[model samples]
Target: MARAFCSSDDEVRRVQSALDEAQAGRARTLAAFAVTVGSDGAVAGLLGLNEREVRVARRTVGKDDAHRVAEALWERSRLDRQPAPQDGTPEPDSTAYPNEAPAQPGPTPHVAGQAGEPESSPAVDAVLTGAWHTGADLTTLAAELGLDPDFLAARAQQLAAEGRLTPTPAPDHTGRHRRMVEGPPPPADETTYLHWHQPAPQSPHHQHVSWEQQPPVTWGTPVTAPQHAWDGYLSHGQYSGTTS
Candidate 1:
């Protein structure tokens, strides 16, 4: 009889398959253990344990080694047909728990448009005070702040609840207009002008803000007239060589 010899390639493939199966088993065991531990034993984010600590914990199981322990317990329970507890509550299934998320620290506060950092409470006040006078409506204010109007309104409502802002009185009993309260007084009078940018369009909602009306002013700031005064700039070709 000829002796049978296994090829090296076949042996290598067999070993690789075994390793793959083992990894899959370990993954399943870990999943089961995580769920079994429930919220109390589940730690948020990655375990900060060092390699040596992890090795020791793996050998001598601790609270953090719930998955491995759960796997062993499950195997014994299934093999022995262990009696269920009298209370009839099911033992936790570690497989159900998801990987914990990383912890987030508290918010970082700063002033907006200053040093390129978002403004904190005081900075928010300063920006708003300088932003609109004749009291800007919430939508206009939100546009100036580069935020969505609805988002700004929600924030405004929250602030109002906290006594930081006040909701404007209903325009009519029927509630036609919904405006936010005026922000804090500016450092100077509201009439004082800052550099006027190009006039915004005069839509029906914005008609009150017109060229004849002084540009909206912040408190403590004097309105400065533009150097070249023109009511409205006209195109050059539009007026070319036409008799007066």
Candidate 2:
């Protein structure tokens, strides 16, 4: 006998209704041979399977066929509905689903060489130099050099926070204590000045004698470019000058 299983309009509800009718041994909307095809290609409805048998198999029997029927009914119901607005306001070059907004790119950091303002500064140079040459922490180095630790830390932290300095972690309490990590060296207060070596002048090996008893002698070729020359001189193992 021909019977309407379930229509797309009310596929699931209709199938369930039929199942109920069959279980109760009442009139069934779905026939024994009628079947429903879901949007996903699952099959619902029954053919040759009696009402009571189908009910038992689907409800009490818990057969896979019952599950297939439910899935089929759902899928077919969704597919049979009117086509959704495939192209809202006419499709653009790109196809986007309805209710979806265009994607936006994230903001990028302002690089030094780019059109943005220059990021280089004397403070930044000092922090970087301290970190490289001495392997010192930014905050500790700045403090040791009598600089504002906050300002120095900011510059160094910028590089670190940006993941550029992934090799080095940020300065913490531990890093601050590392200021003295260089270890003890010769004290700067030592006043002893002893001459180590002197290069002969390219000239006639000029020698000058003072008439004054034990005339004071200048040291180290009279150091012309004296940038931190005093510190450099002090660092020398032996310092030499007229011991007046």
Error of 1 at 123 (Å): 99
What's the distance in Å from true for residue 50, model 1?
8.4
Worst 10 residues of 1 by lDDT: 226-235
Clashes of each: 16, 7
lDDT of 2 by residue, 1-244 (tens): 1235435547888888989878643212222112232211121322444455444333443335545555666678799895876766665644455446677788986664435334557666655544543344434555576655444444555554454433323333332225345344344343432222343443442343322234233221222222232223224422232111
Report the number of the highest-TM-score candidate. Answer: 1
The alpha-carbon deviation from the true structure for residue 233 of candidate 2, after best TM-score superposition, in angstroms, is 36
Q: Candidate 2: lDDT over CA atoms?
A: 0.43
Q: What are the per-residue Cα lDDT tens digits for candidate 1 across 89-150?
A: 87666656555444568788853333534333665554443432234454455567775544
Residue 174 accuracy (lDDT) in model 2: 33
State which candidate has the highest lDDT: 1
